[model samples]
Target: MALCTPLTNACKRATASVPSASATSVLKPCSSRWRRGNATVAPPVTQDATSSKGPTAMVFMNMGGPSTTDEVGDFLSRLFADADLIPLGRLQSYVGPLIARRRTPKIQKQYAEIGGGSPIRKWSEYQAAQMCMILDKTSPETAPHKPYVAFRYADPLTEEMYGKLIEDGFGAGKGGRAVAFTQYPQYSCSTTGSSLNELWKWRNRLEGKRATGEVDPEGSIKWSVIDRWPIHSGLVEASAQNIEKTLATYPKGRRDNVVLLFSAHSLPMSVVNRGDPYPAEVAATVYAVMQRLGMKHQYRLVWQSQVGPQPWLGAQTSDTVESLIKKGQTDLILIPIAFTSDHIETLYELDKEIIGEAEQEGVRRVESLNGNPVFIKALADIAKAHLQSGSACSPQMTLRCPGCVSERCLAQKEFFAGQAKHLSAFSQ
Candidate 1:
């Protein structure tokens, strides 16, 4: 199948609005610098200066990781504090921190195993830069207004990033500004929703504190949010193609008999039972990729990296592997669909735990399609489409129909509203 292309006409129209001479003018260079233990220091751009138009703003969404062992407590506090993340009411106040503290040793150990810390923030920054490069190549007209920026839920970029962008003169009517959420091929409330809520809160705080002289006038620029891309066919095909490549590396005969295990992060059964479409969405993605591959190989969908005591979606990948081993299955191919890139879940849980189990179970070969180039290109394609079509500002369409309130949505709504009220009191 041919790769999907962005809306060219729309891009042309958007570009034509900017004058040729002005478009060719030298743009203020933006630089990002970081020190090992110090906050990032970016070269300051003159906020008062105006180019032909304003800068393009892009925010990459991420589930921020804990940077220091000491931060584990506060990190869990913020994550659990959000009702959307943990729908358990006031119980979360105590449970959230407790869980983080308990898991700190394990989590810290995992981070230690793969360097000294999680590279999510750094990877996100690199992705933003790569995305900017692609956007520039695809649409040079908007190249000057690089809309590339990274933000995290529990770390440095915080609400402060928004303020910085606004200070550097990015907002509505100033230039072509856009926000892009970074989860490719699949979307989950836990990842995407949490990041977006952070952005919303940051925007609200920055705009709210305007009276306190904390707001940047240039920041008042209009901006649009681009958050979701549901199971695009391009991504599906790319993933399947990547899997085929991985299969090729194995002994020829073993390839055909490989057990194709598609894995995703498991959510609590309460969430799924309540009507969250996460599981269904993940299924759809698996089906799409499987259909594209045209494979008759034995396959199963399994969940990995489950947390909290609440019942999570299953069959757990490790448990499933054990069952398959008993049934005489040997070769295996693990496809991590829940995550776009390798993280703690992928590096430790799936790689260390599951792979170790597979080896112990006598599985001869185990393969993974995590961070394959085709998959990365698929992500770049998704981002390019949004920018080229000027659709980055469009609201994400709901997977569920209106009035369709799955029991999950209803429960989640009630949970969120109550938490919102509670959080609101603290804000006031």
Candidate 2:
């Protein structure tokens, strides 16, 4: 894969800036900032990469991590600086950098504990490939489902992926659609908001055929989004099934005695106060999973991945474990509810750090879901369902995000209009 970075004024312009030059002409020689490489001019993309019978590109969006220890600081910097993540307004420019710098050492230590980097990119690649294969088989009408990934904070960033897809004639030709499929199971202004906003910014730059102020042009990229599906049947079934297998880790006769702890990544109360629906959506996932499991065992939803001195959603996972242990309940299983793969949070925070803390309090075990096939398939199914009908967004889609009481969610309803504009009906 050729790695390229923006070096021209065209790259800096917002989506609808009419260019005297074509998009291909604006994209020039690869800069060294993308990777360690010689200055090499990329070949111009032809106008005929799309076929009416073939499928559109299916792009999976997620928060990425550094591939190695050396990239950790940059990754953290990018993550914190994003207005979508921290949303500190004008203060973000200063505060985001300061936070990233201040937290690097500790964050690096956490990454180091988890084998010196994040497995996120690798898992995302595997998941994308698997999803393409599944779609190819399950929905022959949408053949040749090209899979791409756009990580918000790391390599293969959303803009980079968008450039590649555009260069390939995606979203600019007949039947040339682009799908922004989010990997985040639940939606929040923080996670899905950031990713979609980045994508839309790119789409605005390449405003389909609508750019020339013409009718929806023939080859312009028709866009759709798969934002959130926290309670999808496939997803809920996968989590429950995985937990069922995890229950076996305990004594056979005492399976009912073990407590199930569903964990979600914590956001600041400040963010929640701003009306982020993350906590409610996370609870929805937990409720659906527990319903599917139908276990007599008790389960509770707890929050993890908290940073800074500020308050976050609770009961905190660690505090919950301590309380449970004090009540003479030592056996525990920690299932990361909001995560799709085992990153530093799952590997270090949930499994090692939390489990270590629990064992100190006489807790027996702590288990995590590490890219379970069932879960991966659930993700694939979510993507497929959206592909079959390209309209699963925040406000109103297949799920009940309409019931979101978050003022932010209510205010952000208009943002998902493009998703509604180009919905693909299910193909036989």
Candidate 3:
């Protein structure tokens, strides 16, 4: 992808005004600095000084991990309690805490091994900031793109993010544009869907409540979604480029035959049976990446991180690695196809558990797209296209799964899709 020209005057002014600070200090979320107060008074972001068409919130949504070992319990408790992710039915409230408590010790140890915490929060912040920098240049019509990350099951939770937005004046009886950009390139009810539903829940509670399926009333946040970009060219190019870099590490003679195992977090078979689009979407990403690479090597899409006793999506990533080695194919490259950044899944699960247990020198994993320039540019491209299109959400986003029964899905989809009526007001 060609690079956009230098930052516009508005972007330059925004950048020039920033205080000289350490990179770590600059990348940190501003949530700590600007806390929500009892009074809803805020400097409304009706228009940004940078540009007349400005002050857009580029909120990246993802499933977050605990930042430290001590947070493991709370994290797991929330994760298990989320009915969208783990449906325990009537027993959810009773059984969720029990499962979280029992699993805390083991999960804490996993966090301890991987540098005492998950690096997801750091990478997510960096990715969001970089993408917004690019967006400010490429899409000045939506210039002054402010970055915010709303994570499920962790700090900077959905409510916290919405609060920060209002505190910074995105929405509090004032209209402003915000995009809920899911970091999970592909859409899944268990992942992206869960995040969106939680976002909708908060938007209702913090802002005024509305009919479950009604559009936002006047003077509310004008929202849109970049719901999924499973097969975007930039995504494929980035994945293929990373694979090429990893493949280059092998001996020249062995590189051609090295198996590429594209792995994703496994979904429960029940979710799959419910017609969740995740599996097919993940497969589409892998296929797109392979096609971009001209199908240079043998590859298979495998699943990982199965929890509980229930059958999950497979052939499992670990099993595939062991089987390939048993067949004397020692050289392999595991690619995390489903997620953009590393967390417990990529760091501890794939690295320590899978590769470490395999005891094979030939097996390795590709680096996550953390702070990857190409991937960041791709994010900007996706956001730019969405903002320009003036679509409230993807056409498919309004559709429910064939086997879907959740009223939350029905209402959330309707609420977001309904924003179509208000999008033009912002775009103009």
Candidate 4:
């Protein structure tokens, strides 16, 4: 029962502060002395019309995968170069590309099986649109104001999309716009944090070159960002429903015997040591799902898609399956909680390595919950709530929050600055 504040609760507190007073006062005192006096009263702050309209920009943040085998090398190079993603020194320069190239063949095979491309980006787009539709139905006013847009960490929607959005008049200065980060299910430093960092960097770049010809010289856009809604109970319940649907397809009486294996993307130990709550946040999601289902069966949380020699978060999925085999657990159901859609990790790693290992260990049945309808609906619900609330998704606003002090905050600030420098170097 380790306690961690949920994202929704944090947003409520963060946005609940008293509205700032304006210079024009709504009330005029009737006293002659007051009338004669030059004292001025502050006016009430007016809320943005779009704020009532709903979230203006529903930005889907994800670790984009390479579309073609040729792009794999460059993709890995960028991924490895990201200090936030790898945390390894210059070793990533060699190891990153090396591993990516070596795995390219197998990864290519998996993509072929799953229709010659990774579905993550497409599914992300689908999820974003679905969420927009749901929000529109649930909260029509806000829905039209908030349109869905997709951004990727390693692909086309790079920092450039930020400028494009502004140019398209979806930014802050053009009109008081509301934006929400839609990384479904849960958040991780390597994924959500990386995406947000890119957004902030783009914003900084836009602001810095507002007058110069170096970048888009659009009107100054002020952004109110709602980021990182880690785990939503609605989403958890939806995941449970997906699990139930998958389990139902299996033969009866094999249900209770099937071990539920919740999988998330693994990160290096350095990340957790530095105070990233990704692991804990994932575990909480699993707990919520199981609780919603009222299941008494034993479930295990395992890490997947581990790379490099460095220590990654565990128990690794492969090892977990082996241990389960020793305990005579034959049937297993893997729920990829870390990802809301099918991608390289899901199509290649878990479906290949873990499934192969399970077969070798004499496991008979292997069930999986893909990005099904329930899961999509759950995401929609979470996004709708976020739009209505007008709050950032991540718990504690990893960005500078007033009156909060910790070494982690200082480190994040330093990291933010460092990333800016790196991007500047790249641009130059």
Candidate 5:
């Protein structure tokens, strides 16, 4: 989950793209060509007794970043232009590019601070490798679980992965199914929703190709998703392990003075009003991690990664840091609960900007969770568990928002309309 930052006014909401209805209406009646298309009928591919007819193309989905500094504008362009992010309707094509071009210089500086580009692709690829290794060992029945990275706005985009899957004979029974294993543990319409929607678009387009009698080379295409896993036991355990390890780094005496804070990307109130369940599910991850650590002193949860001047979830991290300073509490341990790896948001935003605030306030110590081995292992376990289970998603991993009332949940998907609900109204 990435945030629009001040360096770029990427958070400015454009008028909602689809008319007369919320984003939900655009997704309705489940009209994607992927779902409407026919399954490829092909000669049977022999499979070992333990193997499922096809290999698993597991793509770790994320909002990709530039590999080089110059490409940052391209990254920002795709991000700002996304209907999920800015919703500019027809004007998106015009203004979104302008927004990206305008923000480039400032955003470039931020990327430069973190070594020229986001390491998200690097980290996500490593995680995918680890997941493939685990899946190979633990679930031989689904052996040959080929791992790939799918970014919504950056390189190795979903469409790229889709073409590769079909080429490799994974489409429709060449013994392959695509798995969009979300990198988000907690669901959000902005993040996971955007990723899923894009993937669906690819499927819908592929449906057209098949209609032209372009047979799926090896097998029928199928999709399985592991979108929200906020409370997966493996994930909680890994987080607890990292928290325990990182906390010990602080002076023992100062440890008790420090607050264990969980920071997440913030969403606009308008997005939340549309029934985004991000904040609440994020809270669930924090609470679960807190429990695993067995902390008696209350921990904290705060939102970060806001951009532009629009309303966002709060107490904003900077504001929260200031409040803590005012209370004469400076020692802090920040766990980026929404991110699985260290990228711009963590390496620069939280580590520098936000922590710099604490330092300026005379806060003695601060730290963030970044690619802990345990966390990676837990992620592998989560994805592996999903594949071993027959359902599109593991039942245990579902974290639907409380009182989720979107018709799109049933209309567009059994899983994807899938964020925002049951939290206190947006406020600081």
Candidate 6:
């Protein structure tokens, strides 16, 4: 959920690279080659031939980072070119690449520092697989939930993931159900919205394109979205547990006095001004976690990872940390509130850059929610509710931003919401 803001432009659709569909689509296990220390888990449950309704695809959606230094250039380029993100207008083709090229070295260095890559891919795959395993038992009607990771940028891009789904026998006239579960707990037009738009774009492009492989659009995968769940109780409990673990490191006398700084990636005020729901939803998560902790220590919601010289939503995290220390509030716990997994933002930026600069033993960051059993259970609970409810998407997803002028957003929303017609048919 690391967002980079640059010069702004009116929202318009941008072209994306078509992934090589010819590439073999064998599902790979979590690779130890990426320096991720987490142990590999078994794959998600497969479809049962005996079950009438099974083989559901649970696709985890997020803005992914490069897995290695070699991928930073293309990752940044795809990110900057996304109109749903940076929105560089007609110059997107020219400006996006230039910016990505310029920033590649620095971003690669950051990734290099954080165990040579982002561990998000590893955690996402593990979480998705684990959640599906729970779902197979808990929601057996939709048994055998297979996990897929769809990154907006980096490897396993939207196109690649969609192709894998087709290869896995999801679409191509053999109708099935798939859930686009956004990994961002709080929804943003720049984050989850962008990912959905990409998914919708490919859904149209890849399905029913040619006579040789024509897909009956009506017979394609029936889709539903778990768009946002910023305040799920399980999520709150997991976050509270992590905070408590961090607080225990402090001495008894000082534990209750330590300030809690809950930080999330900042958005450009331009997006904020467009009535994007992210800022409010992120606040909701912080509030819920604090309440679950019984509001013991003082806390402030802060923003981080604002790139370029634009007006971004703040009280920036770095400035707040420095100010708090100056005010003699050195005992602080910094929590990465919005993101569920560890990435450069947490590993390099918070660990090496911010806390490293502070040079205070009193300052500490709570561990990320990655592979947290409670958090993984929360994911399964959310999916189970969605599966049983037969809803196309959350009601909140139907409305577009007040300032949204992009036709892509409108079409994408309508397309997903329209799946309500198909959900009832499949649930039986």
lDDT of each: 0.52, 0.63, 0.78, 0.53, 0.65, 0.80
> In model 4, which runs have C-alpha deviations exceeding 4 angstroms?
1-55, 90-106, 145-149, 209-219, 360-371, 392-395, 399-428
lDDT by residue for model 6 (51-88), tens: 45677889999998778889888888899888677766
Tens digit per residue, CA lDDT, model 3, 267-306? 7788899999888889999999999999989999988877
**Cα error of candidate 3 at position 89, Å:** 2.7
Q: List the candidates' TM-scores in order.
A: 0.73, 0.79, 0.89, 0.73, 0.81, 0.89
Model 1: lDDT of residue 69? 48
Please give, for residues 143-254, the per-residue lDDT of candidate 5 as tens digits.
Answer: 6567778898888888887766655454443344557888888888778877877886675466335443443232445667787889888778777777776677778787
* TM-score, model 1 to reference: 0.73
Which ten residues in a row are the worst by lDDT in model 2?
1-10
- Model 3 residue runs over 4 Å out of place are 1-46, 210-215
Task: Write one digit per residue (lDDT tens) for candidate 1, span 130-244.
Answer: 5555555554544444434443435655566665564444432122344445553445555555555566555445542332233332323344445555477656766777778
lDDT per residue for candidate 2 within 1-428, as digits (tens), equals: 00000000000101121212122121222232321121232332222233233465678888887777788778877887776565556787898788777767767676666677776677677667666667666755655566778998888888788767755545433235566788887887778877876776555555432243434444456667777888998778777777777677667877788888887777767778766777888899999888887757888998776665677778888789878888888878777788776566666665566676566533433333334567657766776676655454544432324334444433334445644665544232
Give the count of colliding residue pairs in each prediction.
Answer: 9, 5, 0, 11, 16, 0
Worst lDDT run of 10 residues, candidate 6, spans: 7-16
* CA displacement after TM-score superposition, residue 147 of candidate 3 (Å): 0.5
- Candidate 6 matches the true fold with a TM-score of 0.89
Q: What is the lDDT of residue 189 in candidate 5?
A: 74
- For this target, which candidate reaches the highest lDDT against the unseen true structure? 6
